[model samples]
Target: MGRTASVLLRVLGMLWTAPNTGLGLIAGSVGLPFGARVHFDPHTVALVFHRWPWGPGGAMTLGNTILHTGETLDAPCLTYAHRAGHCEEPPVRIGDHERAHVYQYMALGPLFLPLYLVCGGISVRNRFERAADRYAQTGRGWWPW
Candidate 1:
């Protein structure tokens, strides 16, 4: 998409997921000056609350991890980098999945939140999640497997 459309979609995504995104922003702001680090990229923004050594022990203290929020694919994301685990995929991969979620937020608008909550338990097969996974893996194609 063109720059304008992309920007519009991102704004819409933020509005669509306002509650969570707003909270994320607040949390990020509170944490930023307190040893937290925020990283920005073309497709994602990540907020790292702590840079503990990567290992099992570090993961324990970094409980309660939160992922991305907002309508834009490159929205602010909260995560514990140390707990990303054995996937070995770059952290951006998680952001790619979240970008797909931004698209979902754009498509569903306000309805997305309630629907997401209702489907949270079965997210593995949820249409929204499946679409997001597809977008992350392939960048475009979608299938509801």
Candidate 2:
């Protein structure tokens, strides 16, 4: 798992840094229910979403952060493609919003990972995905709607 995480981070970093290539998602154990594909063009970044079994709120928050910061955030499930067309300035995402799978593990590890393995894991992922998705649609990050 450690090696896989390391490799995933490296790959995500590469994808995030590369411009115009679009996001190539690599699903992991802790990935979202239905991932989304993002394409960053010259002016705006277009997101093609695969709606998760859960609702939409987490993805919206996270995506809005990337949009607000003008940063490129890439994870196994969710990713942000840059509109700048340049790799010099890469987006900086931290904590739960940094990567998809990592955040899932972090979310479920404490209380839920021990209980129902599948649902617990998916719940963590779905939450974040919802946030990012909402963020995309509303242009508001995690702020009370």
Candidate 3:
């Protein structure tokens, strides 16, 4: 893609995903007063809140916002798996998986959540999660399908 086209596409993606991103921002901001720190990640093109006081003890990607309970996202972990730990054949970076979800939100816009649930709310059965895992493991295949 040309430079102009790439820029335009990014603008459109941000605009298209604004609603979902808004929801994520709202939910994520609730943690700010409790000591959570937020920063924009250029690589993921998303806002990430670290040391978020809610959720179990991993991370979640909602639109362009990522909420993480840990100090660093590059740490090995599964976004939603149970005690999956860092035992994949190859180490997985949490940031990469969450970045895929950010990209998915850019592509699907408001439809991301509904489609994610329909695909499977949360589990290994969900293709969306699987795709994110694939992206984290191999740096590709973040699409919902």
lDDT of 1 by residue, 65-126 (tens): 22322223333322322233423323335556655555565556556667766776333546
RMSD of each: 8.4, 14.8, 2.4
Residue 63: error of model 1 in Å?
Answer: 21
Shift in Å, residue 135, candidate 1: 1.1
**What count of clashes does model 1 give?**
2
State TM-scores per candidate: 0.52, 0.20, 0.90
lDDT computed for candidate 3: 0.85
Model 1 TM-score relative to the real fold: 0.52
lDDT per residue (tens digit) for residues 64-103 in model 2: 1121122233322232323223223233332234233222
- Model 1 off-target regions past 4 Å? 1-3, 30-35, 45-92, 141-145
- Go through the candidates in order and give the clash count of each: 2, 18, 0
Per lDDT, the best of the predicted structures is 3
Cα lDDT for residue 45, candidate 3: 88
Residue 27 CA displacement from its true place in model 1, Å: 3.4
Off by over 4 Å in 3: 79-88
Q: What lDDT would candidate 1 get against the real structure? A: 0.46
Model 3 per-residue lDDT tens digits across residues 12-90: 9888999988988997899999989999998888999999999878888887899999999889874444434534355
